[model samples]
Target chain A: MSSDRIAAAFARAASERRAALVAYLTAYDGGFEHSLSCLLAAIDAGADVIELGVPFSDPSADGPTICAAMVRAREHGATLTHVLSLLAQLRAQRDTPVVLFGYANPLLRRGATRFADDARAAGADGVLVVDLPPESAAILREPVRAAGLHWIGLVAPTTSAARCELVARGASGFLYAITRAGTTGTALAEADSDEDAALRRQLALVRAATRLPVVAGFGVRTPEHVARLAPHAEGVVVGSALVEAALAGPSVLGASVRALREATAR
Target chain B: MLRTPVDHRDDDAPGSFGRFGGRYVAETLMPVVLELEAGWNAAWADPDFRSDVARMLACWAGRPSALSPAPRLAQALGTAARVWLKREDLNHTGSHKINNCVGQVLLAQRLGKRRIIAETGAGQHGVATATVCAKLGLPCVVYMGAVDVARQQLNVLRMQMLGATVVPVEAGSATLKDAINEALRDWVAHPHDTHYVIGSVMGPHPYPTMVRELQRIIGAEVRHQLHAEVGKAPDALVACVGGGSNAMGLFAEFVADATVALFGVEAAGCGLHDRHAATMARGSEGVYHGMRSRVLQDDDGQLLEAHSISAGLDYPGVGPEHAWLHECGRARYLAVDDAAALAAALQLARSEGILPALESAHAFAALPEVLATLGFDRGRGEGRDVVVNLSGRGDKDMPTFAAQLLARPETP
Candidate 1:
């Protein structure tokens, strides 16, 4: 359950022309069993990684659908512990790495060190504390590393080269490059010259700053977006595009995994 | 006069009510919200302040707004409960919101502050603030939700006309709450020179208290007027609760009056039974902005998005003191749905020729229920006096009201 193992899985998936499908499901989005069904479906549909969102009181950077999903999850009595238990179930079934994606509250509420230990024990290989940046890395990095978990940091296009280099130095496993300034689940349309240039420069800066690989995410809807991002980073992360597929399909969870696999192949 | 809490005593700490009001902001802007809070706090304490406000009310804003008695409303409800509305609609700027904004802006001038910043929900406060800033020759920056700006184009134009800068926040839900977040971020970014005059009685400690104190002028005046007319205070008082500032302002004067019932009506967009914005009826103790108050939160304590026809009352949370009063059983919380509030708005306009602000109509809608609680037949002909704070005028809401009316020709 080390973070290194999780990064390696993604690295392999990228090299094989098979996307590392990251299926997103809030624990107890419906019932516990329904949540388990979604989890199982994602795995069966070829998702290499599953990102379980730990619902919180305030999720500042969330889209309507994801926000609604989080509401549904909380309504069904899901907590950080509940999410970990579900991840434990998945780990029992397969060796696929599970990533815990959430804001800092639940993690802080759960006690960062304790959360890291529990996440690793419950089959989680890495953690993405969305609000915490390199400046505040001490909040989670040491504990995560001690618990044999990867600390994945997102570098936005707006981030400066110095900050990007700092992120690279602090990052373990791989660096995540968030494509935009806003929240999740929006489509990638046009790019600003300054932003695109800054992202490329940041990637180069990250490469120079650390040995870890960098992955680009946010608005990677199609193969074109992937192709555009692939040459610049180690891999591409498609969350909203796959989420859209899940939402459109009869089996949202299964469709997400399949859409990602197909999109990466194309 | 009943012994108000020591902290609640007027002129105790210059701008403070108890431990509540003080300047809590970044060091740069520490002088601004503080200087303004202090100047206004001191000015309102001056006997001249009340007279100046009164003079403005009469000559400029057309004050002594009619105390319209809703007789038809009284007759239909089968009781003699008289509904006397303080016609804030008669004010030049339309709503009672200008009452606070004008006071603050005048005080801002006294403090040598040249700029004002504020956040608006439905653009009522934004327009009011912009108006005051324009009249006082002060620069104003009003943060508003992009969605609201699009919907409330007239108000946006009004603000622009008043020479206030409108920054449309495109973040989060693109609503009042997001507008507030953007405003706070702006304040944090430029705390040194700007005075952030909060629109409602929410935010941190001093804000909820200070705003209520400023707004108390409404209830204080109403209390004297009602006393002169009826020989005693009305049996019940009602006001709409967004962040509950209006209600808090009106209710504060009567909190110690055990016999005088106070009612705070929340916007139940659908119903309180449904997932609506009835924070007092449906919410629990939670902290947001600065104060620990009742907020519309889901099972995991996540703040739920609130829905209401009135943008001012569409907030997902109630003021901390309102929450505390509810807990102490000093005030009753009622839910007024969007349809009910709209109906009340139109009814007031048709009956009294007073087009009430959407938020104020929510208070009007709850009058029927409050009268019923006071042993009068609901919505009927009783002479039992009930004072409802008509917080604002409906001019700003005309476009929205017309649109809604056009969409629902069948539903009066």
Candidate 2:
């Protein structure tokens, strides 16, 4: 099962006494062929899980870097179906667990159930729609898990403990603890500040509420950001930094994810 | 002190417009928005807050703007309809947008936020937001699409003169949709000290519901004024819809009144097929700007750029409540092309000496199509009463109006 794959990835990282490195890259960001090469490179460089960001025209929750990447990806003829096809091709080559990430409109345009089943058939292990909170997720949640794909939940510092429990109810792959209360590429606040102290409290709250492994993300830029997260959560997701690297080329993205991978050591 | 803490145990905060409106934002915004929802609920429920908003509307926004009888314009259209104009254009900010701006600005104060941000398409809302912020001594930032900033230069200058910084967003066709995306980005980054005063009855829950409540003063006044003038319910209520705030403001009072007919006219830039903002005619049901409304989107649900000579009406989606009303057949919606709206503006200016905002001209253009149906022709005496919401004045649209009409002295 997909949940077992995600759990095994976490357990494997734990056996090595290190937090897992989940690298993110937009499918078709540079171009379909370029993105595929970068994805294969990141996986080869020891990324425990891969988050394949499906390009969208209006990515409201993202910062400028990811937003621009999505625009470039769309210009390259990206779509949910096209990204799923990319996923299928990647699956033919590798066994790394992959999560499909995007907003709700594109997934909803394809019909929630249809998209979930298609994503699963494409060998997707999990799904995370940024705007589909637990309140508005009813239409997509059941179909997502029933397709044998894990349901990943995002918990922010602003989310109260009870809401964290509500999110963890159906969550499977992992709980994403937002390290900051901003979009995807804002700089994470310095430690010892009120925001850093608040994030620590949120991690404690999420830890108390869910059995699902918590992976802190949002604004995570460097190995230092991953190292900061390693002590508090089970994993770290490097998104914009890796995306910026992929735009530079495949080798730069490989070196970037590898550096993040090394920072996961306990 | 925060008026409302993020203490929600669930996602059951108010602001659902019958399955169309809900908080569909990211988790980072989810809790803070819930706090906003709670703050709004408490503020509105208090008699003090209600009175404060009412006082501001009357004193600052020029509430109870006269319902002028436009018999000359009505007769020129060759309809028997006795047309009355809800003169929202005469308000302090030259539009009905001030109603929402003042309300949201006050809400921000009560919530203890220090900065104000807004998105504007035509700059009317931006001007209104800047006006209110200036009065209240809050720093204001307005996001406008680069396309709009170029066209609506007068209003842009007005906002800058009012001490608000105007930002021209260059992303995504560089229009209202892009401006809104930029505003949402700004909000998420500075959630603790910022309040996004959404200018229309669009976006996610709470915003749809909140904006509707703020603008409802228009319809409420129309009811009392029409009652005193003609002493009966109107036969039909007409307004132009961009994001549909002005129309919803006028229609909210009459949705429960079975005797009144509601008509919402959308912009057809040239024609629906070639270029237009007629979401009701061409859009499919999907989510945009936080609400599930009739949206102009491609098959993949990517938003399509809307076109209208009037920048205010060039939006890709309608309000969620308007969507529900269309779903249940409570209102009739149709398209009014740019040429027709241009003619309507010329007719009103010649007949009644009033140049309406191009957005408001769309409502006037629909008067002919709707009045004949209500038996408001020249000879008919019964069921001839109609009210058209002139949502704003034409001062800001003079450049576009002059260019479109082009010095043809004789009225079309």
Candidate 3:
């Protein structure tokens, strides 16, 4: 199954005693061609896994950077079908594991099982919906897992330990550790202060709740930020920062991911 | 660690009105929302909490707002139906919004939240939130869409006067939907200190149920007052559906009574074929702003921008309970255009001395349609009693009214 690719990628990083780099790029954000170039660039620059965000209109949990990008993407005629086709195009050029990330509206609109079938066919390894929590997303998860694709679980800083166990139960691929309780682009104050310690504590609880490879994310920017927090988790997801990099140009995005990947060395 | 306790159980159960309302927020907000749910449940169960909320509603919001007979309105309509008005317009904040805000801000205090945040399209909910926050001594921040801020500047000043920091959201049409998005983002950032007092019976689980129970006073009082006035329930109830808060409040108590016909009026803007906020008439089942409900969306499931002369009604989605009501055919949903609503507002002002908010005017505009369906006596004899929820006073809508006057030719 394509999902085994995720496990293999994490194992590859574990062999080197280094955290894997999970990079998020909004599919069709800068238009399809620009997004495809950026995706290839990120993979070439050491992005072990690509979390391709499908653009949504009402991204309530996302901050300004992502929200604006999503709007621009939507204006550029981005749709779920186009995103799946992007995944297919990416598959033609790369072997990097890709997880389709988005809100639940479009996914539910297409029927959960149908979405899973289409996603698998398009070479998507996993799925992560920001709004569909474990309590209400079983119908979605079952179909995703049934399609032989990994269903990514998200454990937030505000998630109780008991709830963490619930989210981890049927979760495949890896656990996405939301390092902060805020939206995507909120920056951390510093690298190794009390904030990191608090995150480390929460990461500990998340690790205890599940044996799935934990990837810490949200507000994760800068190589220093990644380096300071790398030893604690199996992988680190750089989202909005990478998006900002792509906005600067594809080369800047590549270099940003490259630097963040280097910092993952344990 | 910012971990909060969450009781994760079966989906579609918490605030479900037959598979309509459910908690669909992010994991970042899920636990905190669950905490709020638990707190609300505890508060509702406690007698002291209930009495405190009731007392505040009575003293602060001026509860039991007058329900009077619109005699002139009935005569002007030339219908046998005796028209009555539930004057939520006379409430302390000039709308029914204060009732929910009062209860929610108090809950914020009980939950030990230091700050309050709210989203508003028309300044009514924002002003009410600011008013309650000022009374309760909590710092308030209201997110208004930039377009709404421009249109409802008086409401902006009112919120500021009540000591709220008003933020203008500039994303996705910059209307109520965008404001709600910004507010939810704010809540995600400051989950520990701030409480979002959702203005409508929309959003996630506890909010829909909580807001409904808080505003249930509208219908509860109407049932009693109308019973005392005529020795029985009114034949019909009507209210505008802008996130369906006022309508839900008015329709909730009468739901069990099969005899009382319920009508929820939606804004049709210019016309049904043109720009409109007629979600029920031209909408599909989609998740929006954390609830699965009837939403106006494009083919890709992206929400379409809704249009209404009334800013409050210019929302893409209605409350999930309203969606359920429409689904089961328990109540009828109708759409009234901007011109009709404006005409109805003027008619009420001239005939009944009641100038209603543009949002409420939609309900007034739909009354003719509602009456027609109710089998009204064409002979103009005694007929059914129709009670409409005049949701707010039209003071804030004067600028729009004045613009209309300026645009019209002089009748010299």
Candidate 4:
């Protein structure tokens, strides 16, 4: 099943004594063909998991970089249906775990049960609905779990300990521990300061709350940043930086992913 | 004394108005929304909390705003209709926004929130929130669209003067919707210490119902005032709807009165087919700004930018309750173009010495259509009473009015 593939990816990374390198690319960032090339390139360059962003009109959680990529992807005719077809194409050639990252509106519009069945049919391993909190996750969780697709949960810096436990209980494939308090694409604070300490405390709390693999994302940009966060997290997700590289060209994105891969190795 | 219809109180479901309202926010903010729901429920049932808000409304913000007759405006419409203005403009903050602000600030205090954040379009809500924050000794932050900050400079200054920080949002559309996006982000980041004082009877749950309850005083007072003055309820009610707070306030009391007609005027920037903020006239059901209301969106469900000469009404969505009302035919919504609204503002100012906010002018501009719909004609009709909600004063909109209407004609 899809959850087994996600589990296998983490297990393999653990056996290799390195953190899993997860990369994100908005579907149709440049265009369908170019974006598909970028994703393939990232996988070839050593990304274990791919977070395929379904371009949304109002991405309130994202900063300028990701927001700009989504706008470009939309202009290039990317939609949820278009992204699912691209995922099916990618799945045919690779067994790498792929998570469909998007907001709730499209999924809600498509109806939860049908979206789960369609996503699974398209070879998506997981679904991360950005706006669906644990309080309302039941709306999507039942269908997703029934379809054997992992329903990813997110815990933010502002999330209280009690609430974190509630979120962790419903988390499936992994829990996304957001490193900072603000939206995605913001710069992380200095690695060893009060902010970093606070992040460490939050990560520790998350680890204490759930047995699921915890992946850290949002504001994770550089090789050194990955090296610093690898100890606390089982995986690291790189989004905006890779998107910036993808926007530049496929060659640049390949180099960027390779560099991140080498950083994860250390 | 006028009797409030018992059936109007029957639909008491939390966070929903006939499939139009629900919490569509991110998970990071869900716990906060749930907590707010519980707090609001407890507070609503508590007599002390209710009386405390009542006292604040009566003593601080000035309650029971006058219902004054507008003979000149009625005469100009060329109808035998007798028009009365529900004077919310005379409130402490120069608008009806204070009513909700006072109640929300009190609720925030009860919830142990020390800081407050809000989003504003015309700056009336921002000013009202800042005023209550100042009175309560709490720090306040207001997010406004960059475009709104430029147009509503007086309100920005007013908020600052009241010791609140104003953050200008430079996101999509740079208007009310964008400001709301920024405010929601802030709420997610600081849900523990801050309370988001939503300006209108819109957004997720609890908020739409809570704000409407606080504002219901407008319609409730109108019922008593009209009863004493005209010896009966007005035949029809008119109010402009941006997020539909003032209209909801005035409409709630008379909802079950089969004899009363409700008219909600929306801002049609240029026209309905052109750039306009008439969401009800040109919108589809979609989720945006934490509510599943009728939103101005493209075919792909992307929110479309709404435009209006009046900054207050430049929104892509209305309150969920308004959408329910429109769908069920409980109230009729109409669109008034920019030119007609401005003309009405000027006419009211000239004839009655009352300069109304551009938002309120939309309702005045619909006077003719409202009378025509009622089949009332000048000097040869049944005498019917009409009440139009003067939601705010024109002080803040004077600059926009001057630039648009009072400026000299350009020389070629």
lDDT of each: 0.70, 0.88, 0.90, 0.88
> Which regions in candidate 2 have their CA more than 4 angstroms from the true location?
B1-13, B381-383, B407-412
Q: The CA-based lDDT of model 3 is what?
A: 0.90
What lDDT tens digits, residue by residue, belong to model 3 across residues A101-154? 999899888888999999999999999999889878887888998999999999
Model 4 error, position A136 (Å): 3.7
Q: After superposition, how far is residue A193 of candidate 2 from its true place, in Å?
A: 3.5
Per-candidate TM-score against the hidden true structure: 0.62, 0.96, 0.97, 0.90
Residue range B264-321, candidate 4, lDDT tens digits: 9999999998999999999888777788888887755677899999988999999998
Alpha-carbon runs more than 4 Å astray in model 1: A1-266, B1-59, B273-275, B378-383, B406-412
Task: Give me the displacement of residue A234 in model 4, in angstroms.
Answer: 3.4
Q: Clashing residue pairs, candidate 3?
A: none
Of the two candidates 1 and 2, the one with more favorable DockQ, higher being better, is: 2
Candidate 2 positional error at B129, Å: 0.9
What is candidate 4's TM-score against the reference? 0.90
Shares of reference contacts reproduced by the candidates, in order, are: 0.07, 0.81, 0.84, 0.38
Could you tell me which 10 consecutive residues in candidate 3 chain B have the lowest summed lDDT?
Answer: B1-10
Chain B TM-score, model 4, reads 0.96
lDDT of 4 by residue, A59-140 (tens): 8777788888988888888877888889998989899999999887777667789889999999999999887777556878
Full candidate order by DockQ, most accurate first = 3, 2, 4, 1
Instruction: List ranges where model 4 is wrong by over 4 Å.
Output: A1-4, A75-77, A109-122, A137-148, A158-171, A187-211, A262-266, B1-13, B256-258, B377-383, B408-412
| lDDT by residue for model 1 (B1-412), tens | 1232333443554333333223322222233344555666677688877676667656766666666666775665567777777766666667767767766666666666667899998787898899878777788999998878887788888889889999997755577887876676566444445667888887654577667876787778778888888778877888888887778777888887776788889899888777577888888665455445677765444567788877788778777777767765678889989888888887777777778888898988887687777777744434468878888887778887887764786955
* Model 2, residue B371: C-alpha shift (Å): 1.7
lDDT (Cα, tens digit) per residue for candidate 2, span B69-187: 99798778777668899999999989999999999999999999999999999999999999999999999999999999999999999999999999999998899999999999899
